[model samples]
Target: MTRLVDVVVVGGGQAGLAAGYHLRRRGLDFVVLDAGAEPGGSWRHMWDSLHLFSPAEHSSLPGRLMPAQPGRTYPDAGHVVEYLTDYGKRYALPVQHGTRVDAVHRDGDRLLVETDSGTWRARAVISATGTWSRPFLPAVPGRDVFTGRQLHTVDYRRPADFAGLGSVIVVGGGNSGAQIAADLALEGDVDVRWVTRRPPRFLPDDIDGRALFDVATARRRALDAGRGDTGGVASLGDIVAVSPVRAARDAGLLKASPMAVRVDRHGVVRADGTRAEADAIIWCTGFRPALSHLAPLRLRGTRGRIATEGTRAVDEPRLHLLGYGDWTGPASATLIGVGRPARNAVREIAALWARS
Candidate 1:
């Protein structure tokens, strides 16, 4: 059976829902296809101890504010899930849970969104499928020969999982690596070695995601006006000092060591020609965009990213890519930052649809 909509949102996460909200404002017919079995998207699978980098009120989609949690500066993973689930309902967005998009290709004037449940030919397609589904693990030399268990940020859950391990090596310098290392260190008994390719950089204690978003916004505005690069969140530094990370760093437990030059059958080989034995390795290296379903479009460049003019694909204007990162729009990957890009993308789609 074939279905049709003015727009088909490929992922029902924050980016998709935000785009949906604006689409409704423009009176466009659309449906959101989510691969998750439930409404929360990737938040449901995030680590149990995870918390938003910003407070509840600071993080929201287009239409409603996330209800603040009592006695907490930051909302936990479960809180985010509840908020996202409610956001979809509050707007009465048409989201089809458990529908995984298998492919997207041209179907004459419309794009065919083929999914596990069915197919929908949409006049425009918004690919908001964020990077959570695709975890990246670096190919460090001798990683194939490592005898220890390896895990990525997506696969990690709790510190208790490593209760009996001799030593745990966490690889990466970002927020995930810092937090995961902190979580494991909080266990008190586990030996944790945090590794980074370069020296780890920590943002000041007062700065959070909201501050970062503001900086990014300023940088974008400056660039748009030909004011040259004013620098964004990277200027502030890397990891934010959320409570756990702050405590871990203050206690001298989250100190970063240089990344091991190579891995051995037993563990890792440090640059000093010394070996560190590890029972487990957690790779918090980050993720690539989840665009495998868009492969049929053949729009990706040598850089492995789709070239875009704002959110619209350069090669296929009918398609828009959202929430991938700065190339699509500055700070578009964060909850607080995605709304602008989503709204802009939908407006562009609406204009194109009107002309067609």
Candidate 2:
């Protein structure tokens, strides 16, 4: 028997939980399906030393404030996990844990959500599966021949894993790359080399995720108003100089080189044909959206991402995507940013049901 609901939220992470919050407020019958055994989502898998670029106050969901840690400016990953776990409990959101969704397809005015446990027929589906499960590593020539250790940022747990390595290269320019490089260089005996496609942009020392969010909001408003210039605002891509990164910079270890062209048996080969010897390569390249469950719908546009207008799929209105990042909505992947889109998505879904 197929259970039916007004809506099915395909993830129990920040985005899915936020959507659940609004859906409950609207008095909609909705169920949230989480693949994980626990409630924290991807935050539970983050490296131990990781901390939010923003302070707790600036990095919160819609209703509850993330509790500030005593004597700590930025909350660690564990703190976020705890907060999310508590938030779900407080709201009593209808989240089904350990239920992995396999596929979603159209079933005549309703969407069929097939899961490992059972199938749900929902009037609408909100996909918040997020990117953590889809880590991306760029292809380099001769990569198959490399005998050295290679891994993506998703697999990285601690610098101690590479402690005794002779040389290590960290490939990426984002916060993950910078922070991981800093961690390995500061805590390990390995020689750390930072590689980026372009020189990384670092935000001012006084700025943080709060400032970045404000700028993003402003830019979003401007774009909505059909105006262009955002007055040269900083982007989220700019690195926030946390203490370890700052120390690494001051110690002259944060310097980056151009991306390597190929991998050799011993190490990576530069564009200029020079080779750098390394025992391991950590690719912090980033992730693609986890939209595999929606594959049967054939809703993807270019780049395998569903075309969205403020969370609703452009082609399939019944399908909404959240937490996939800026393409779906401004700052949709962050803790502070997911709420607005979630509310918007729920409002649209409710209105659709009203007309039916």
Candidate 3:
């Protein structure tokens, strides 16, 4: 017999868990279907040393507070995982771990979700998978010909992974690139090169005590323009965007521009006729929207990412999307930033369910 649920949420991370918990609080019937063996999807896979950029106070899920530490900065990835696990236990949120959802299909006013475990039917769905489902790799010529190891920021576990490498080239100007470069530089005489197609912009942390307000203004502008694309607010990308060149220069990681680039499996040739060599290349260029698992739901877009008008649900109206990169105008893509949009989605879903 196919089990029925009011709403079947995919991806049991902070976003999914928040939606599920909120639904439960409202006495709504729902089930959270997660892909990981436990909660905290990417947090589980994140680099060991990675910590939340947001304060712990802002990082907690619905109805629960993160373990408090007065005047603390942020919690590490492991701490995030622990908090999520405890949240499930505390609320008894119905989440099936290790249950990888393959496809979600609409079966006449209901959604039939296929998974590795079993099939579930639900009247609605909340996709809380978030943006990091897949890492985006850029196509650089002769990329495979390089004899050295290459990795995406996603696969980067620790600086120890690159410990012995004498020289390293970190691609992209995102926070990941900057932090990795900084750490590598700190680890003895390791040569780190940061390659960014264009120079990144910078904003100082302490500028008349209005740094926070400046960022808030930018977000508000994005929201007003209807492009609530999060992920660049304080992310590795945003941090680097503020002044990557300066940061890299100060760390001795900056290099001359390659005006004309040609890869011969050894080095990058500049358009101004200069060659720079690298041992390893780390591409933090960014990621493409991952919707392979949702192949069945033929959404109206080039990628499976459904383009929305305001916050309206696409593809299937009953099936709502939360954290579908750029779907939530201007709030940023982090869990803390995604809360309001998720709540808004919940309210809209509730209204739709009530009408149904």
Candidate 4:
């Protein structure tokens, strides 16, 4: 039997949950399917000491307000998960957890979405699966030759996991890399080494008038203007341009080289003439979207991402991708910035449903 709905939202994180809530509010029927056993995607996989750089007030979903707090700093990973769980209950969102979507394809006018659990027939599909679906690790020559343990930042959860490891190298200069180095330095006895590109320009936790809000608003407009795609020109004004480098430097976590040429049992060879040896290498490189289940959908784009605009599906009107790059705007991939895009997506979906 093909279970029918006005829309089917894939991924039960903040973006997925937000989209589902808005669709419901617009008097539409939709179901949210999440890969994790619970809500909150990266929040569930984030490190123990991880905290959102954005303040809670600005990080709240569309309708719900985050719990009041004294500190203006961003909420920690646990706080984020708790907030999302509350958001789901408050809205009574119909989210099906532990339902990993296996494939998504078009069945003529409708979309056929199959999961490990069951198949659903939806007029629209929201791909809120997120950009961090799979952790990306660059392939370096002789990488497997390294004697020490190697892992991506996604697999890392606690500092205790690295205890007894004498020395560790944290690769990448982004927030994850900087935070991981700091965590290991403070929590364990291991000496921390950072392999990164340029140092990030770290802004204050709160920049001009709540930086998160400012960034989100700017990104929303950019998305609406259809300038949020991957290939779109980089208009630095639209994204949060703050650098995390100063923070990394203050923490003594900055490395000289950005590019990794190769790896061997000895150490990592730098693009310049240098080598770094360590007992473990934690690659904090970004993630690539896992669209294996989307093979049946026949998405054609420069990258694997499915591109769409203003509710009219790219190739198939019935197949709408919710969380794909710039689906709402340039920064739709972020936790705090995702709400507006999610809201926009649901409204677009509702309009489509109404016309049918």
Candidate 5:
């Protein structure tokens, strides 16, 4: 039997749920399909010490405000998971958890979403399957030759996991690298080396997710209005000094090294031919969009992204890609940031239905 819906949301994380919220409000029939066993999505897989860039009050979805955690300035990964779980239930959004999408392609005028469970035919498909599952580890030469155990951001859990290891090298200068290095440094026993391709850039202490988001929004507005270039998020800086990262920087615990050009059997080799010994390596390199399920559509570019006009795909009119990052919408990957794009996506879908 071919199940059918007005809209089929792929990946029931914050983005999918947010889309569901707007879809429900417009009286549109939709279903959010999530691969996770429960509601939290990728947050459930984040490191133990991870916290949101902003306080809970500023980091919320469209309809509901994330309640503040008592005594915590910024909510942690666990808190985010709970909030997402509650958000889904509170809205009574139709979400089929544990449903893994295998492919999404066209079946005549409607889009066919094939999954492990069954197939759903939808008028519109929103790919909110964010990048968590697809961690990006650059092919540093000799990476396979290294004797040390290698892990990506997705595999990391807590600092204690690296405890007792002789020397640990953390790669990438982004927030993940800084925060993970800080977590390990706090142990006072682990030998840690943090490395980045470029020197680490820290946003001012006063800045948080809210400021970064504002910067992105301003940039988007400027381009849309044809105003002279106002610098985008890059002007703000790369890493947000969350509590642990801030403390580590102040304490001289978060020093980073130049990127390693290659890995050797013993350790990593720097560009200048210096080899750094390591027992383990943690690559906080980042993630690529999780769109392998859409491979059948052949819409992905060389960079694994699709052509988009706002949230809607340029080539595929029936598909909307949300929450992948800035390319989808301003700050579209964050908890608060995703809501606007989610609304825009649902609105476009609704408009399409109306026109049809």
Candidate 6:
């Protein structure tokens, strides 16, 4: 028999849990379907040495503050995992773990969520499947011909995996690329090269995710007011000078080169015709939204995103997207940012249900 719910949250990560929290407050019957074997969402898959760009107090969900970890300025990945697990348990959020949703489509007025476990018919569906599952790699010439090890940020777990390698090339300009390059440089023997399409933007030493979020929030407010642009505002893409990154910069290892023109059997070949022999290459090239499950709905817009006003889809009124990125809501991918959009989406869903 197909289970029916007022809402089905597709993902059990921070965003999904946040949606569940508000849905419960609205007294809606809902279930969160998570593909992971356990809780914590993408935090569980981050590299071991990863740290939050913001402090614990700044990184939290809707109802509870993430308990601060002693002696750490920024909580590590493990701390985040523990906090998320506790958050779900604390609210008794109904989550179906290890359930992979394959597709979502409309069955008349209700939406049908087809999963590996079974089918779910819901009055509304919130797709919070964030980007971790969709790591992106640029199409570099001869990439397939290169025989050395190649890994995207999603596959990277630790620098030790590349220990003893002669030379390694870390690609991308974002925080992931900077952090991974720094971690590999700590090994002290492997020749590490950082490559980016453009120069990396390093925020001031004192600036972190908290400050960046504030700047983004302000920019959003200005845009809402019909202001033309907020050019001076900082972006979440700007790298926060966390300790390790600072150390790398101090050691002069944070310097970046332009992206390579191609990859050969030996290593990366730059536009200048210099080939850096590399034993391995780690691509921190970022991720795309994990929205493949919504293919049956054909709701994709520009850049493979579901066009939405706030969190509600423009084409499909009952559909909402959360935690994907700013397109959904400002800073919505962050722990603290997810709450606002989740609340807004759930409120809208509740109102629609009431009218129905």
Q: lDDT of each structure?
A: 0.91, 0.90, 0.68, 0.72, 0.91, 0.91
- Residue-by-residue lDDT tens digits, candidate 4, 1-356: 67998789888988798787788788788899998998777687787777665567767777887775556365777888888998999999999999999988888778889988889998888877776768898877988999998989888887788788778888876667777776776676787887776644444533522554455466656655778633332322212222333454555654435657888796688888588788898998877766677787677587765666643457766655555545445456665556767787777766776797
Off by over 4 Å in 3: 69-72, 207-237, 240-262, 310-312
* Candidate 5, run of 10 with poorest lDDT: 183-192
RMSD of each: 1.1, 1.4, 4.0, 3.6, 1.1, 1.3
As a whole number from 0 to 100, the lDDT of residue 67 in candidate 1 is 88
**What lDDT tens digits, residue by residue, belong to model 5 across residues 174-225?**
8899989999998637799999999999989899888888898888889778
Runs with alpha carbons beyond 4 Å of true place in candidate 5:
none
- Tens digits of per-residue lDDT for model 6, 228-296: 667434443467788999999999988999989999998999999988888889989989999989999
Number of clashing residue pairs, candidate 6: 0
List, residue by residue over 190-306, the lDDT tens digit for candidate 2.
999999989998878777778777787788788889999585345444688988999999899889988899988998989998889899999999999899999999988776767
**lDDT per residue as tens, model 3, 1-356:** 58898888888887787777778877789898887887777789886656665667766666787885444466778888888888888999899898888888889878899988888898888777765768887767767777777888887777677767777777776567666665565543667776767664344543211233236446656666789644344532255322323455565655524322555476565667677677677777677655566667777576445766434555567766665544553342565555566676778788887887
Which regions of candidate 2 fall more than 4 Å away from where they truly are? 229-237
For model 1, residues 189-236, the per-residue Cα lDDT tens digits are 689999999999999999988898899999988988889898688888
Candidate 6: clashing pairs of residues = none
Give the worst 10-residue stretch by lDDT in candidate 2.
229-238
TM-score of each: 0.98, 0.97, 0.85, 0.87, 0.98, 0.97
Q: Give the true-structure RMSD of model 4.
A: 3.6
Error of 3 at 42 (Å): 0.6
Model 2 pairs in collision: none
Q: CA lDDT of 237 in candidate 5?
A: 81
Q: Could you tell me the lDDT of residue 264 within candidate 4? A: 78
